[model samples]
Target: MVTRRDLIRWLAAVPLFASIWPLLRLDDARAAQTPRRVRPGEPGWPTPSDWARLKQQVDGYLIRPESPLELCRESPDNAECLALFRELKNPYFIGDSPVLTQTCEWVGAWRAEPSAYVVAARRVEHVAAAVNFARERNLRVVVRGGGHSYLGTSNAPGSLMIWTRAMNEIRNHDAFVPSGCDGVIPPGPAVSVGAGAIWMHTYEAVTGGVGRYVQGGGCGTVGVAGLIQGGGFGTHSKQFGIASASLLEAEVVTADGAVRVVNARREPDLFWALKGGGGGTFGVVSRLTLRTHELPAVFGLVSCAVVARSDVAYERLLGRFVAFYADSLCNRHWGELATLLPGKRLRIDMSFQGLGKEEVATLWKPFWDWIGLQDDLTMMAAPSIVAGPGRLRWDGTARARFVPGLVVFDDRPGAPDANFFWASNLAEAGHVIHGFDSLWLPAAMLARERQPELVDALMGATRYWLVELHFQKGLAGAPADVIAAGLQTPVNPVVAESFALAIVASEGPPAFDGLTGHEPDVSKAQRDAKLIGLAINELGKVATAGGAYVAESSYFQKDWQAAYWGANYARLLSIKQRYDPHGVFFVRHGVGSEDWSDDGFTRMADSD
Candidate 1:
């Protein structure tokens, strides 16, 4: 008789067997000789009757592989499929399905071609049912909120996908307290946001409905749950705090399909883990309650121009901006200063909350004084600038108008056909000049000299290369201990300590040859890879010893664990073991995910 212990010992003898060892029981492995792939519509896959039963168990509908709503590759424009697609309140496609080809374009380089099922979960019950179903069939599961994972962490090939977009619902809860509070509940207005709620929807509902705003993603389509879970930053972050810092409570569905309400007073460890731990790792968050603040009336200014003609001029301007950023860090202010090379331009956008025009002018006087010393520079300010209630709009229809005013630009351009590699570094106040000198300058020179055509192609195609410096001062007034107290989260501690975040990124279009029939052109691919490699290498030098931002980091960073989580990685791993011992939730580059390969195949860690 082969015992479970015996099977474990046997599997332990061979490294290649590690992937399958966790899922197989002694009896099952002994009976089957070897494992086999389970395809859709097979005995292991749920049958029509099984799906029918599942539909009755939840408050949501179930879609089968053969349903009219199933997007077909051969007949993409099938009348039935089109009608069903249009009717779907929220939709996502499975691997090999026609719709998957379009909907799977999150980051072109890492898009998953999954061969499993996709579930558009609308209700909490639907999510629970999906989790139970996946467990029963021994299927790997991936949860997607906005499907915006740049590393393709949201979807796995051959795994079940729980699409949460349909679960979007936003509500305001004024002065509410949790059920199991040991102390006084924090006062003030709070908003309960659904996991699937996009930033724009929540922004509109909270700001317009309650005359309040919460720190959230600048982009309208970014999901609230994913962003907050990953330590979101935006225009209001410097004033309010990172989005996760405002989290009051959360409803999470764990690996066992049990829904748990977590807060400081209940499941405190999980509460800490959920605040800044990378999304789609710990559990599926059903809803989140966040603190909200009244929207402040403010005066703002926007200016941009090609100010530098020589490298000396460029360096001088960069130094001036760096000094300005350091000063802002000491004095609580909201603004961003950026420089785009080749044109050698400087752009400054600032907002002074609750301040009059004269106050705003007085605050910006030093910056204006510095600019006055430069004879060759000219600043162009936008017209029709006004200040008041109507100035702030958060709805979708106003997205186009509001984004430009906020200087919120899309990093991904010509997206579906183009792929980009990006890296982010948190620069301490003292290291700002070192970061620019070591990273941005060298890369800019290299692009102009060695890869002129590549530079031209990128500039013409996607405005490819950029080095951004974002100023945030939310943590300036707080002491190191206070910041450390907040550091119980999985977000990199460097984000709070740093004065600016430097983003170095580059893009390359697909190198497919028409005559070769979708096959990538090797020469073009090699060239693109080389250019991207240079950018990555240069940026790696600028990254502070502290850490990097997870959201805008390179998927291929060598020291990613330290770069993304710093000292918090160990605690996050411990939490993962306690909550998900089976490793039910896994994403590329997530906690405990080092054991998995790029293809979503698991390999047991040496310690395991």
Candidate 2:
């Protein structure tokens, strides 16, 4: 019944009415904005009462920064703390705390500090409770097994750390039955170890106590969970298989705080992901069941050092070593640590399982003959063969009494530490030294030598360069189908076809002067590391074009996804998304980690 002019006047006021609606609603919203419930220490941080309640819920103690424990007392220079730090089995706890000067010296090359709290979980329920508490508080959780992550992903700033070293129980089974196996037990001689157990302790328990062995890392301090999850490789890897291949079952705590037993017959997808997918990405592994091997009574050991006079001579010598290593006998473990000092010295160490000294000598006859022809090279000593435990010795130290998986370096207190940057690459059997026409070419120029410009570039950058090679050909000998099947996991696919792993490393002093009050810059450290890494990568490009070893790779790799996981990255990403939809777990250069940047802080990739 209103006039047309009146209707037009009302329409003009419609825009003004709409603008005022939000203000009226905002007034109501203000009344509803109640303060969040907080504890006593800080407005939002957990208080003493909250910590006390959490302690009652778990079997283990919740250690606050102010706790009177030897590791965390009021006095930073407490003598008890120093003593405890030295004997602590877990390396991560040694140097990770910002307040404590005691650090695990093994990882001095790559050290980082974790901000906030550390939870030393004793039982499965403790881990679950910690996870739930972190989720409820909206705090990020970082899992530290042995604290051996090369990229220092195990510890982060402002994260709730779940330290698993206290859960170090190992149970041996003659005929083990995996969980969810429907009453079907696998073969005999298996060991179930707590995820936090160090490899040295496990090795001693199974090998020294039961006369059984498991293929694990050479360094005994490596955590069982970290090694097995990241594709463990040791001196015996070529004889049996990688550490991941020996996994029978595991108990995992997922992001949902559900404790699930994963194996081949149960939770198959998670099982596949846990093996070689890298640790701290899928879930927290509480326990690991692994197949053990019979220990050999005795084995043959060979040790020698060769000196090269010139760069050309060094190249030829290196090529001969590679060629011989490619076709060498099986069940033989050999390592070459080459350095540019004293012109060039290549340390050759080998151990032959289930073989006598005479047989080992015969096996090495080809290499000995090859060494005799070089005029500029000299074998410092005859390749001596002795009968003893097949322990992989580091540097040129005298072989210690075989303790069956005892880590030679880490067990010692106050071991020398160095800051270094390293990169790794895998070379297929056919591609190793293929450009060389003959093994006996003493003065022949090789690919590396042909590019004099590259050599000049390398010499100009650093004082010393080191190349460490480990020959692992077990997977390569397997049928293609078997290799393909194994590659379905998160392990680097290049390992299946690689005849040798080449690790190129460079060492230098700290960039800044500590005495002059010059603080360390994270960006500058990363930049220096990248330059050294690039030089090493360039030197071994042709020899290791297939892929790179994740454990020893450069931290600043540009094509990290392809270099680490190869074709299996997409599947890994899918699995990561399905299990950890909220991105609960993360490791540097790990699967699905491409979305994140490499700053000292842990942040989402999108934020960068």
Candidate 3:
């Protein structure tokens, strides 16, 4: 075993990444004493000279982040602000901005805010320098890669941010073996992605360019490191498994400023914690290597809508779809979302893998025929099942040749042609969230005898807010090997047995703080939030378990530890304490975070 002390020595020996900073050697005795975390203008804050010396250490990569919204605040009608608004809807633009968050704001909670300073990290040394600086000063440090954190863990008003946006570099490997596991683990095809890389670029390199598949987020803009840390799921997760389960190794900068490589062999406990232990909690993962899978022959979508003319008819439609999902659509080939909306509407925006167009159409014929028998149901959309070559599914350059108008490309100056986001995800770009909550829906609800109960729950919930069933987020009907792999992560154990993850939420337009006339309608947002809460409570009656994806859950979630990690919380916390004993890495709801206050600025307990 490579002990943490030995790993530190190894990192120092590497000439390319020698001890960038003297590690903040926190002896066991000193680690027990909690320091009062300070903010800018505080007594314990670092002076200008202190920041300058640290900045020098990173070779001028440090920066002071200024929000683009500042221009909008000064003059709402100005050219720069208007031009900024145009690009605000582009998630690629959002990801690259130091002062922006993919989720602009969550009502009654947090608004996307900038840190006092940002270390625009381009390599492991930059991240280590920032960690060492913040640790010695007892200053709160925030980590933002994709900046898609719904809980605002990645953004804080007066903290230092280790921004990994510039570290995006992707590489495809023919075979990979983790460090110290040459004989213990066999080599296999894999891809090493920088922490800053998004699924869009990853898919393009792995699938489009190399003709192989890698598990990633359905939405292309999600950051690679955060998603894996929080237990990622995608459009075809049932086929392979959660993205975190496929992680073979990670290069992380621990709180102690030691650049360590963790995997199944070296730093085994931290490796396990990184697999589904909430992001921004443990350390800054600079890069990750994931096992890649063979590309399927086809990747397709089935998008259509069914509108019920009456309440009774909607119940029948919901019941039929649920039964169809259990009987045929529960396997690896079927995944993605199907939404049940107000006005008694059923919206199917699902994706499939390894199925032909004709096969998909044939599978849906019986369900469509049943809808035809109902006098109160109307098919609002014709069957639009489109299946194409699997490699083109995420290939921005090649996708348009097959599936037109489904993706919006980044048209900014000097932007890569492959930088684009799914049209379905555009609505989420820079949107002010009203309310969002995700919970796993158990497979037992799909039983023939229990279908009515599930239908009743869905019907009652839609009365309050839109409910989306994300099948790929759960592992109920996945292959046995896939489910077995998923079980190894620290994610909520209930996910392995759930049929789908139900997301009920609402959001508004970009409501940047201090922008007049463009601010979010708080009254309307509060109203919607109440209704969203009601919807989740309705579904909660039959959910049978308390579990929610930490990445897409409520800020007010009461039992977050259990809901996010279930029985794995204790083990994760133990590992957290072992690696980050001095509380250098702190995120809201993260393991060992209960010892600190919500803002991560002060200690709430002593020697927990």
Candidate 4:
């Protein structure tokens, strides 16, 4: 739980803005603006007076109550601040904290308050100003880039958000790679990338033009900052290691508001902490310069979704998926499974980079043969090797029915009742659908039948099908060493890679069926997540008894220093203390406070 005092302390650590005019004096500029229309059931259609009141709360921070507009002149070069001043005066712009209103409903949701979001310069100076202002005023600061966090930590009630959507610029220095680095000649092909740059955007810039590219997220929409900072896992991870391993340098604005560039060469501790330390911890990153490589655009990304006939079928599927992934590892392709769907469908999505379609087929033949899908499956290859930078449009209401133990990497089958509750178990991967016949499948089929373009887009650029294995008390015997090696090992072939498993579902209205049978599922289905905690305690009894414990998906509250920091926990704390001693960056979802004297850290403090 991120306590209020912790947040306050974080704010204190930030470097104050240079003696520019206070941000508060800009209120009078919008004193006479009229509010817009209000509609029923609209998420953001506050009434005129409601808008007025909300705007008042927002302006109260920027204006000195008695006199507004006096602060606008302080920083004449601040385009974002000036643009915000103009946009706020408009009737359409309503100021509401996205945290309370939307974050709880959907993890990836964002409100487009024209004046609410600001993308400061790539340089640290602009970041310092934004951080200092938010800290001085005690405004909760939610940082946004890619908006992919499953926890919805990027937005807060009554908080100001710094949206990094506009920071998508990518600059490549052809002489930064080790091969290109001679004693005098700097290094071979290095790229200084913007935090907001998404995987697809970076891919296009790198591979579309030159043959060179760096490791990025599998999902195109995932941004470089969040994904890399979190120790990104992808198909490429098996060959090149996780994305963070490729990081060379990062220009960041610490909690104290001072900008610092940390790398292996300078500020090594900060550099070490940045790799897999997770985002929103020590500072706000503006730019990340990573190592690059040359690769093909039309390489093979293999996928196999196998259907199971019964519990025994599921066991075979698990064994085959693990064995195949292990075998593929020797060949430089990584393997992973999604366990925890209600039914029994064992599907494997594999990626073989730098290989053509024929090569891809040959590499995946053994796995297909093992699953006995060599004849039953139909392989639909996309026309182009690359896709995206497109828009995101979901049907107004979309729901995900997920099981808790699905993220575990170990090959475990479902206990009698696994899908009944919201028990999140410690596993290696996130939710995996049992069969394509689930709700999401029909939806996809409908989309394919109705919107072929959307279907084409999915097939061409993304892993369209997701198959997960549910790790339960009993499913199969222990995974062999060859399989485990591929499951946990890292590679450094073409791009940096890593794996992440998360349980994502919609917090819908009362009418939605996604949450149906919540209580019954837990009682009847052996679906209590707390049991996992018990199992962790009884680790020896289960595994030594011939079961295996997967390590990828451990669940811990942010305050639980052990769970949050993992192996790198100690270094992360030291970095936090050194960089954010004043505590300006505290209000984020996971970051702890600098001052721990008043109250102990606990999950209860995180609740309303």
Candidate 5:
């Protein structure tokens, strides 16, 4: 698409000596350039003419996104600033903006910053063009879809961002056979979603529109692509399986600007890597197709909280709950989370499929009866159960009547009625994360022989901080077929051997760094981080596994390669070198990320 005049204009933007590139070979010319990624105002940064050319190539979709927080400093009391602060509380409003990440800050680690240029990509060609441009110019490349990374991997300053927010497209296929898999891989029901499509929207199209289910993240606003890459878990994961295991195929743009259709049959190794291999590591995934399953007959939830009057009572309650869970709720019908609180209390927010209200109530009667007999226990909040048609669980309007504030609607004018997030997830919206730690608890911990020690550890952890056990993140008691299928993914093998993942995390509302009166309290953050680590250590006393969920684990995780992927790290690194050898794409904690400097601008020498 470039004319001689355009080529001359681009060449003019370069240093005068670069006009001699015609005399040298392409490979020789490349060797003459520096490998360091450039930032604005730095040497060899893209010129105005170069940027203009890129903008034209992308159909004028490029933009310089700025943070709204800047306006708060400019006019703190103005209507716009006040409105923006209010909108910050809504996840959808935060996601629509390119500069604002869901997480505002991460303790002493990182803060949300605006990139210098954003390619608001609406198609695969746009993404490829942006990637090629960044590679050619030695510019740091950042990609974001949902902008929900707790580690803040999606946003960076003075970089070229391939913002995929505008590419939210969803399509359904009754019998989708991946490219080159016809006659070899049988057709299956599937849904193809653009990189920017969030779970809430995808659920509406695949579950609400059609009577089928797609395993996705429990949080409604989480982006589908990122979750798939991180081994997604949801309320019904006990029955279906992890989200990445359900991926049938993907359309990706590799570092070389090649658009590849990867699946189990075509580019098999790359497809295997895409299954929980980590996003933005191998390439920029343009669209993904995931297998779907038949909808269950019923879906339900159990919400309640209980407190203990004495430490002895708390220990006894823990013992009782552990025994109760193993005996009644250890099967595939149950999922979601339950928290052990610091005040010797327990908060239950569990969900299930195919169980009716009265049925689940009967199953919990023995546990409640045992609690009623205790002299030192008190009921903080009585159990309230909601059971309904499974098809209606994801229907925003239908779920609105289940329990008040259970889900918050996105009431922005002209927004889709299906756009809403779980009220429990509201705290994470534009929040500043203090600390997060998680690890798998092997199924053996639930055995009668180990119940006492497990109870001791559980009670001990509550003393420092709340601990949430997400049963959906582990697939030990799942159906044999489900476990076999889920194990094929690149996630840690321990996920299938464990009964649950114990997570301890904390965060506060948006507090951007260096912003006076609104900056994160470094002392408080460090203190809470220590407590969170201490809480996790208590569980580690019983569970010695290094494996943790990549999406929700510690940012400073020691041996992250082993912790995130276990034995799968080696293979993932091999694939990364094969496809992105020069490292055109980079994100902190992503595979092969250790080969680059912390800022991802400098390539290290110790890479394999």
Candidate 6:
């Protein structure tokens, strides 16, 4: 039976409730915005004439609000929309009934307004049609692959948004990895992933039939389309590489609304640019062809301590972690060593294909020596490998564990010495722990203290931490200096090219709060300026210390492009212009958007 505490945690984790408690408690507030009933027999779909008329009417390169309302039947119940709604039979997927003022609002306290929200599209032809329609009308377009955009670029206020949620499709092609569970490989290699397929879904297909597919991202909810374009990272990166590296081909709808099949051989430039160039700046991707890899037999692992919060513990734990990861990068076995602050624990997750205890010990000897673990120490070895066909039967709970916001870096070998040149002291200060190190602390602490049984159950269920790493051909050869600096920060060749939207939603916008949790409007500008200055100073310290900043994870864009995409701005723009001549693809904080990009990019550069 689920306990009251579980209920509390579940409530705390709920999307709308977790952030706002008082608002959730108010029944009157809930009653105010009730669900509107959908009218029955609202026309099966749009007729050709309707589609043509709608296309002809939407002229300007902006969100056609009137067209949207007209597309859908006019009624006091729904707002003005285009006649296209009449054609779309899918139910509107929303957390709440009455639409929030801002569709781009994310966790924390920031609320951003997107240009527009296109009703979710399902079919490939529908996607193609939408792109063509948006381009022909000269409307700025942004596709919403999964709506998980941290920077709020997924949905724009006035620009046309093409949602690909309904486009999820997965199939095994005979030409790709063949499907089976004979505990062995087959002759045929097949893989078919739709543009809307999430990481989890793709994982199911790739790892299902005795065949292993290479992808990234631990979270199952992220759309493959966006993740691939944005250089996805995952627990399995060490063995394979980034999800983009595994990509074979992609069906992309260009800025001009022309759909094209692109791969390494066909349109090599676009393919190269797409690998790590980032998302939205390019065109809408309809489907992706992923490359598969072989699964390991026995994934090995170890845990030194429970937590590492103190200076000594931090140094000991983080130093060892840095050394190990540096070495792992050299071996292409992307390992993750996390330091939990709240629980004061240090854990290392390593992956090796079918390795025994002896090999595991030898590989982790450096950490073992650093931490001084004895031969009799508690070491739990499992015959279980995270990959394989049976992994699909792990149950839905396994799927739920996948979470986003997990930060990653390229801290490979020689990173520390290179960081010394830039004075990046994160490696020195021990703040350069993995994503799980920074997060999972508060929650884990609460779990252990509040629910010891549950915590114990999860103590060491798995042996190896899935080490996800993806390296492009030319990418593996980047200069050591740049790699060293980028390793301290998340701004690598892969992550830099994607739209890592970091939404900073505080309880409210910047203002002068006079003790009542509210800011005074009098000194708002000055207060904001001072606060921003302080934040910049802190980031500058991070950058100067050989560590860099990440705007994809942090909502603020202080040193955005430089810190995020590195020197790929010019190349990205060229791709943008070639694919989208009329600027049909537009995004806030995107490649060329001014209102959002101006402050973030400009300020970061000017500060330097």
Highest TM-score, which number?
3
Q: Candidate 4: what lDDT? A: 0.42
| lDDT score, candidate 2, position 594 | 58
Error of 5 at 376 (Å): 0.9
User: Candidate 1 lDDT, tens digit per residue, 99-119?
Assistant: 232222222255435435667
- In candidate 3, residue 485 scores what lDDT? 92
TM-score of 4: 0.54
TM-score of each: 0.74, 0.73, 0.94, 0.54, 0.94, 0.56
How do the residues 148-201 of candidate 6 rate in per-residue lDDT, one tens digit apiece? 555555544444566666677887665553223233433345466777666655
lDDT: which is higher, 1 or 2? 2
- Candidate 5 lDDT tens digits, 431-498: 98899999899988889999999998898788899999998889988999889988899989988888
What is the C-alpha local distance difference test score of each model? 0.58, 0.59, 0.89, 0.42, 0.87, 0.43
Best by lDDT: 3
What value does the lDDT take at residue 456 in candidate 2?
A: 42
The candidate, 5 or 6, that scores higher on TM-score is 5
Q: Stretches of candidate 6 above 4 Å error?
A: 1-117, 138-140, 176-190, 300-310, 324-330, 340-354, 361-551, 594-608
Residue 153 error, candidate 5, Å: 0.3
* Alpha carbon lDDT at 128, candidate 4: 63
Pairing residues by index, what is the TM-score of model 2? 0.73
Candidates ranked, most accurate by TM-score first: 3, 5, 1, 2, 6, 4
State model 3's lDDT: 0.89
* Candidate 3 colliding pairs: none
Clashes of each: 0, 4, 0, 56, 0, 73
Can you rank all candidates by lDDT, best first?
3, 5, 2, 1, 6, 4
What ranges in model 4 sit over 4 Å off? Answer: 1-123, 177-186, 296-298, 329-331, 335-341, 354-560, 587-608
